[model samples]
Target: MLPVFRRRPRYSIGSKLTLIIGAVFGLYLLSVTVIGYVMYSQYRGFSTLASSHFDRAMTAAELTRDAETIAAEVFEMLVSSERSINAGNRRAENLASIYQATRQRLDAVDASDVVDDQTRAELDRWQQPFFSSLERLDTRLAAEQSLQAAHLNRIDELFLLLQQLPPVATTASLPAADQRFVGHALAALSYAAAALSAERPGQIARLHGACQQQLQQLAALSLVSKDFIELRKRLNRTLPSIFTSRRPLLQHGRATLATARQTRVLAQKLTSTTFNYHLQLKAAAQQAITVHQRMIRRSLFGLLLASLALITITVGAVVYIRRAIVLRINRLSAAMHAHQQGHDGPIPCEGHDEISLMGSTFAVFVEARRQAEQQLEQANLHLQQMNAELHRLSEIDELTRIANRRRFDQHMASVWRRALREQSPLGLIMADIDFFKRFNDEYGHQAGDECLYRVAQALAGELHREGDMVARYGGEEFILLLPGLSLAQTEKLARRLLRAVRSLQIPNDQAEGHMVTISLGGASVVPTTHDRIESLVSRADQALYAAKSRGRNRFCSAVADDQNVMVGGTT
Candidate 1:
């Protein structure tokens, strides 16, 4: 409480306007500075996160390609082994040769170092089962071959008897030689068909024809030509289905044993391939590591550069402000002191800030009062003037002259406190015009300002509480802080507000509907629950974003129930 000045003041409107503009611009600049630094930090973090995932994808692709190529080679080798076994005249020698060859191939392939233990184990599992099946087929084929040789010898003995015996007395009286020869030939043919079935007897007819050519000569000596021809035809028909199914069993054994050997070759190839790619990726990762390090270094350098720039700007601002504002204010303080002591002089005015406006206004008032001192002493006129100024300042938007963020903050605090004490819910709604910058550009600056005012007035009328208040909270963003309301109550209010704003239907070609409409987000919470004021406001802000995302001209509410978090009034 200083002594009341007997002098009055006059203010220069130009100086006052300039002061307001400078203060607003400084605040905007500071906010941009802080946001820029935060964004750069986030960008650096995201880049590092993405690089880590790239490394994993590269490793997986390299491993899969190596495994597939090796498995293919093993399949080809097994097919070759099966053909050689089927062609053999000697059973034991042929099987032994196949076993030795398969074992040698397996050993040679297994000896080479390739792939990891886990991959080797995978190859071994299929190999073991296949080898067991092949061993069983080999034993069966050997037994069949032995029976075939015995059947052939029995037929030859019958043929010898047929040749040495006396000729058949007559066709009606069948000789024992004739019967024995027919019986032996049938047994021989049956044995040959059974033996070939083990060798994938699908080709039995061709082999049977080869045998028949030799037997056909014997047909000239035999009286059983008709029976023999019938037997051959019957055997050929039965062989196809049996041989087709058995072919897979014989194929499986040979394939697995052959493929098992191929897996070793494949393992070596995989080891080499894996090692090669590993080297490549390691080199690439190293390069990436270097690049990452450089990026980190670049970020550090950028931070340093930003820090230096900030420091330089801050130093310049401090020096300039001291000369432009602080020193001027100090000079005005001295003039005010002299004026208070009944001496009057023009107050110093050099700055473009609120203090400078006051100085100039005071100097003018002092000059005017000097001209009319007797009248100034007559009434309490200065008190009224001071109150008017205070009221005007309180209502003035600190940033844009349309109700300050401070007013919103203060009203919100009061509304929240009352809502809590009463145990009634408070509703907070926020709205942001979509593509406002584009709108601002399409419409001139003056038009943009007019649009904001129109939107603000629309919202102001919708705030029903005596305790409720509407104010501009951010650039082109408005907040409606409501007291004594439920979420349903808030949403209903929001819907009405949206309709009212849409009714104005200001021309905004950029808007999807080609009409100016606001996207509203509202949050309502019973004040009984303890929560920070910032968090409540944040929730309302999120709801506003939801409304915008769902397309503008909509109202969304942040309401949480046991069922779900809500976007509008209901989930």
Candidate 2:
């Protein structure tokens, strides 16, 4: 069965090439059209976001500065017997402006442009300071993290202690009352342990309720556990200690838990406001850019397939066309190869035919790809800088502008361990303002905050040593860690700390000195494997108590003996 296959009549080479060049140019135009459409859509979003973000951010900046000026003017009005009426009027005007700007930013800004992160430079400036509010939240988070660690450790210890005793008598083996109490107490301990990680406001309320329940269970268990211990002293040896460790949490844990809840709430509010603002802007930009990139890639890939097929077909067609036409085809191939090698070598664009148009289209594609890559790189860099700024803000204290408690703890621990290894003496001074509570009661919290700032600065100024650090321990209390300082050096430093506060000479009628002053207790010791931190802290506290007892505004030192414990007295 032999079949004769007849070949279809071949078109002229010019006809074949006309079709190829026309089709490729048509694809080029389609790509250009689609790209224009995508660009317009993305540009609207990007530009609106940029402009809106810029305006609001600038407005916020201006308002903050204006507000500060207004505050200063009010202070001047208060302190000066003869204040400038013009300054007062200017203050009023700035206040009004700030109020209006804040209102506009919060409520009246255009809905579509509500969240824009267009200007990186402005965001860089604004976001860093805006995130300063989160410094307070960071302190709270560190406290919560510490609480969580403590809770976990106690729970683990409670379990280990529980393992030392026999399990509860089975329900069948014991009286109903005994069994109920034992089961409920165990369940409550578990609940209390689980509550440590609950962060939501609702979760905190539920946890409080659970804590109440746990207390009830503990009360019920107390009677039974006591009776059991009375009956079987040796077998229930660890139960008393376990209950001691576990029961106080139900009673005294509310403050810590409430603080944690507040921390979580504040952190959520602050981070969602600032961090998420940038985060969403970055996301939107990336998404639009990613879509644009995908479209470009798809176009480039389609063009690649078309070019390959066209070249193959046109090469064959050129064989029939002419040698001169064949030379143009070779030039086109060279251009393709150069593009592949990341070169935009000269393309032979001598004619106004389809091949010349193809060369132009391919050049545009290469240029667009390069531009897209550069844009993506810039976006990535912006995101990284914001992240770094956030991290830096978290470690700083926004108010007192000193090392916060968390920083102090970290620095102290690091220095302590290093000093321990080097066998160097480390000194810790715990100091507090005399009659600060009374000062707050009389002058108010704002005044107290100002006083704290003043005292912290004065204390910081005294510590010129490289390894010395002063930190705001809490309200009205500051701690200083001086590495490689002996008892004498520490006492000298402690005295100097007291003098610094006295130098402030801020009027405080409640204090014995008739001005703001501090009482300091210092402890210095060489680290030992056998020693505990509590021992050193206890000595310092005893000295502090002695200082408070003797009188206010004095320095006291705790001397260590062979027992590796502090003996408290005035130095």
Candidate 2 runs further than 4 Å off: 1-389, 562-571
**What TM-score, computed on C-alpha atoms, does each candidate reach?**
0.33, 0.37
TM-score of 1: 0.33
Candidate 1 C-alpha lDDT tens digits along 1-571: 1223433325543464466557556755765675576567657655643444234324434443433333333333334444333532233234334434543443343332323465445545543543443344445445544544544454454354344433435433655545555554554455455544445444554555554553554444545556545544444444333334344555655554554554445445544544453454455446656776676677667667766666665676677667766687788889989998998676775544566667767867777767577566534477677887787688766444556787777777787788778788888888887678888899988888888888888877776657777788878888888787788888888888877777777888898778888888888787755677887788888888877777667777776741213343211
* Whole-model Cα lDDT of every candidate shown, in order: 0.60, 0.62
Query: 1-571 in candidate 2: lDDT tens per residue?
Result: 1122223325544676678677666766766676676567567755755566444444554544544444454344334432322244344445545644653573344244445654333434543343342243334334444544555566675565445434765446776666665565566555555554444445555655665574555454535556544433422343333334433433334443343344334334433343444454456556655766676677667666766766665665555455546677688889889878877677565555556556566656656766776788888888788887765556556667788888887887788789879999988888888899999999999999899999999999999989888887777878888899998888877767777788788999987758988878788899988876677767776777667777767877787552222333222
Distance from true position, residue 63, model 1, in Å? Answer: 99
Model 1 scores what on Cα lDDT?
Answer: 0.60
- Give the Å shift of residue 167 in candidate 1: 99
Model 2 TM-score is 0.37
The most accurate candidate by lDDT is 2
Evaluated with TM-score, which candidate comes out highest? 2
